[model samples]
Target chain A: MVEFKEVEGYDSLKSELKSLEKSDKPVFVLFTGSKDSSGKSWCPDCVTADPVVHASVKEKLSEGVFITCQVGPRDFWKNQSNPFRTDSKLKITAVPTLIHWGQSNRLVEEQLFKRDMVDMLFED
Target chain B: MRATLMTAMIRTGAKQCCPYAACSSSRSVAYYSKSAIDTNSNYDLVVIGGGSGGLACSKEAADQGARVAVLDWVAPTPHGQSWGLGGTCVNVGCIPKKLMHQAALVGNHLADAAAYGWQLPKDHHVPHDWNTLKNAVQDTIKASNWVYRVQLNSKKVDYFNALGSFLDSNTIKVTDKKSEKTITAKYVVLSTGLRPTYPNIPGAELGLTSDDLFSLKKSPGRTLVVGGSYVGLECAGFLKGLGLPVDLMIRSIPLRGFDQQCANLITDHMSGEGMNILWRCSPLEVVEAGNDQKKVTWLSDDGKKESQVYDTVLWAIGRQPRLQPLNLQAANVQLNQKNGKVIVDDEERSSNPSVFAIGDIAQGRPELTPVAISTGQLLARRLFAKSSRLMNYDMIPTTVFTPLEYGCVGLSEEAALKKFGEDECEVYHAFYGPYEYTIPHRSSEQCYTKIIALRDDPKTVIGIHFVGPNAGEVTQGFAAAMTCNITIDQLQSTVAIHPTSAEEIIKLRITKRSGLDPRAVGCCG
Candidate 1:
């Protein structure tokens, strides 16, 4: 359910960018450590994100492109959309994130797991 | 000039005064009268209970140039236990319990270190060192006690490490717990705290109360915790975190009188942590399981039978004020028949107005450590330093440290509905996933926030309820808002610290209402 854009080596990120051109939507990518030191692999958080992401994609056809980017060895804050790039704004602390493209193509509405806002996405 | 200086100099109100003999007052004659003149062994103020309230009052009264003596049962370290000062909170209850609980959390965090690719060696486990931790906790108590002792010495106020009881309208009788010596006082402040009692269930003798668990030898095996309180659930969760199998049994929903939904969520989260929950069951009896084991039996609804076997059983049903030994009946002090807590008025004075009670002994709706500490400080200000302002015992916040955390301020939705007509109030709520839960590192639990408001002008935010990460810390600021008469707009203006649990108190805005609800959004996640 939880998805992030994979950025393996330089080629993998380029391929992800190339693949996004065919979609009539915007895809947001995120990277977070998935090791035990972070907490637990089957923690209530780790186990649930996948389903949350999967449900969102399946429930909304109009929803833009969503992808998963598992952490590869040697990841850092070098990514162009790194939250620290601006001015230490957004204060991106923890993950199980829900990042979305904003009104502008280059900007993103990257929120940590917002169950409240997620519920609002699907209304009666 | 006199009025202005007196008002200006009374900053922290006395807990820093010299005793009457040593403290010099510029206009001592103006305030003195035949009745107010001190005689041999007479003091302007005498506070009982060296716990929070008594200690604070003693300090303040000394600062106010009032002769004071603090009579407390500053008991010798119990056999197989430790003590220093800081009363029950520092010595026996809150501080030690929190440290043990936090230690358990460290182990829980270390367990999943592998998922983050940090190759921790096999011997990385931090097995709880009971003796070491107990010593550390005692050291803290000792340090705090020394601080109090030094404060008293500096002020030259009298301090008695003994028990105090009311002998008359203003005089008190004291008997040293260690020695048979007796002393008397002029005016008394009663702040003896509360102690837990066992149920009348058969075999209950085999069960352990909190006082005994801190000295537990072997880790609990198949532990059975009876009571649906934060205490029972929290201990159950902590032991579970320490690799013990636990069963939590309660008569009703855990944390009764709280927001019903939060109670449900907290229990669910505990259950998620692998605890077995047995609800609608009250202990009826206990029997020996084996030479080394114990069995607890309970009656479900309509007399159905259920029994559980365990190596350890803990009871967290309730606590009673430690009032009996004080010989209160001799003084005709009113006690709450329902729970045996001494009844006190707005001024913390009993029906016998000369006698005053605070802490757990004084009957109150919520019994929390922070409230007790603050109440103690306030009582000392009025009694010791001669401050006139009294504390209002309303809108206090409390948090239960169950595995799944939750707490609230002001009235709960159920209580609010009863106080105001249900139709005349509004409830705004938000149920969402926590950003923390989304991280690949935490548990898969979502958070819920609920707000209660009167359906009137300003839509005043009267009650706030939260069940999630740091619920206690989050609700503290919100509680201040309610105390300060903060309207919905002022609360809106209090800029929320982003990515923090506290921010949830303000982030909620115009939310979808059930009907004519006037309340704003509730930030819970």
Candidate 2:
């Protein structure tokens, strides 16, 4: 079964990634917007891609670690100096970015909404 | 049955009543009939101009299962400067301007770091590198262009890197260097935005606009910025911040359409920062001098004519909608002749029922990136998803990234007084020092905040204005509060966060009408 983990903000995301670096299992990262007061992501694309990504992971390859990283509120994400954008290893430009950690495989924006693309990225 | 009737009407070239009563032209009927006949049309929506508004609308429409196509083309400036996708905000206006403004602030911080006890070499001269800063800003813009392209592709929105013009009511012709193609769509959105205009005078073409400033190959030295608009002040401010000599000439008022009190404070701050300001001066002519320099002559308010030579002359007079080449008339779209912008109703719909407008191209709306993005998204949802949410144009927040940033939302004090009448308006203001400014002995006299409220009991807040560091960040939350009709009592009752500039809003206790000094009295409130 796939093990899911959730973290908030850039500091927590960095720490989570660091802990997973030494793991033997393949790591998959989904960077999204933090929930607002209503418990829904302010980013529309993240709202659209969440259910699909979550359900697909449970149905498909279930051996790896699936991590969801909330990148904070709109103001924090809009700031160009946010480490998620400036960091060389991450360089995330938009929200709802899915990555097969340490691999060239990644999907951004509406690409995360594509079932076939999401399934392909999760393949062992 | 309707499809059959539409096909018959098209084949017979007969006039048919359109489903939308707003569409009066026979061309509209023909276009609607054609779409009905060909269910597999080229696209359901065609958005011309891939700027902030157009891109957002196109992507949202596609997400709602509409086949959308976006056409974008950047015309080179007179100085032969052009850029990739993402339009003015990314390439020239907002993104690069803010980055350079941040660079200027960092330069000031470095200078002030010495007062804060950061050890430095005695004669260390840290010269600003124009090329380095320009390259970094351009690199980010290029990355944004790639991301926008990727986003369109992933959303299944067709992207065309060509200039598009209306061929007919339903058809559009797009042309690039390599090829030309015509596309048909059921709906069209015009978000072509705006381009800077130069003053009509001798050798005016020799000067550059904001379009060329961000991507200029060399540093703009000894610059002469003509006009009193926000763009002019911002350019002059940043150039001065980077240790360059700048001369700013204003025709009349500085920052027209804004609160005069606040505008004067901004100019005062700019003058104190060592920028040369010539009020009531209008440019008469620009003559080409040797070595790529230009000689600018202007007429002072007293009718005295003066001439000076400078390495660069930038014109920030104004911008007009990019509607000349779009052939809007052919599509039956109405234009506001006074401003050259498309006349859009509250629904963002133009004269033609199937045609809509947004962004700078749309009349009577703030020319802001966030405003455009929100309007475009709301428009798409209404069109495709059957949502009836109309975009609220009121209480929209905007930031002017000057030497000391200025942010405001809702009405200005002057506007509020005029709207609510002088007897029914109350203005509360304060000037406080930021915590960081005290250590460096920086003067906080120019850091000002004001709230305009109704004079009645409870005093419902109508507007908020802020001028200081990170003014945009400070004003944003207040804008939301204004939308909620926050009252002075509610604002004052809110708990304050210590040691931050934003907390000053809640701590306001003095009214401007009291004729008392609004300056801070003690460090702790």
Local accuracy by lDDT, each model: 0.64, 0.86
lDDT of 2 at B90: 89
Error of 1 at B406 (Å): 1.4
Q: Which prediction has the highest DockQ against the true structure?
A: 2
Per-model TM values vs. the true structure: 0.69, 0.80
Residue A99 CA displacement from its true place in model 2, Å: 15
Q: What are the runs in model 1 whose C-alpha is more than 4 Å off?
A: A1-124, B1-37, B74-84, B121-135, B289-292, B444-446, B510-512, B515-525
lDDT of 2 by residue, B203-294 (tens): 89988999999988899988999888999999999988998899999888988888778888899999998898999988889888889889
Name the runs in model 2 displaced over 4 angstroms.
A1-124, B1-32
In candidate 1, what are the lDDT values of residues B1-525, reduced to their tens digit? 323324433442233233233234532232222124334337656777777666776776677666778877743322244344356776667766776677666676577666666788877765665566556655555556655655665675777776776665455677864565444443466777766678987888788877666656556667898888777877787777666789888887777778787788888888777788887888989898786799888888778887778899888897777676678776678898988888887777675544677777788735666666677667656654456677777888888766556878888888988999687677776664555444335663547777788768878887888878767777787888899877777776788776676566576554435543433233344
The DockQ value obtained for model 1 is 0.01
True contacts kept of each: 0.00, 0.07
Residue-level error in angstroms, candidate 1, position A104: 61
What is the C-alpha RMSD, rounded to one decimal, of candidate 1?
A: 21.4
Q: Give a tens-digit lDDT track for model 1, residues A1-124.
A: 3233445333464477577677666565443434455644422353456555556556653555555443332244335455323323222333444433321111112222433234323210
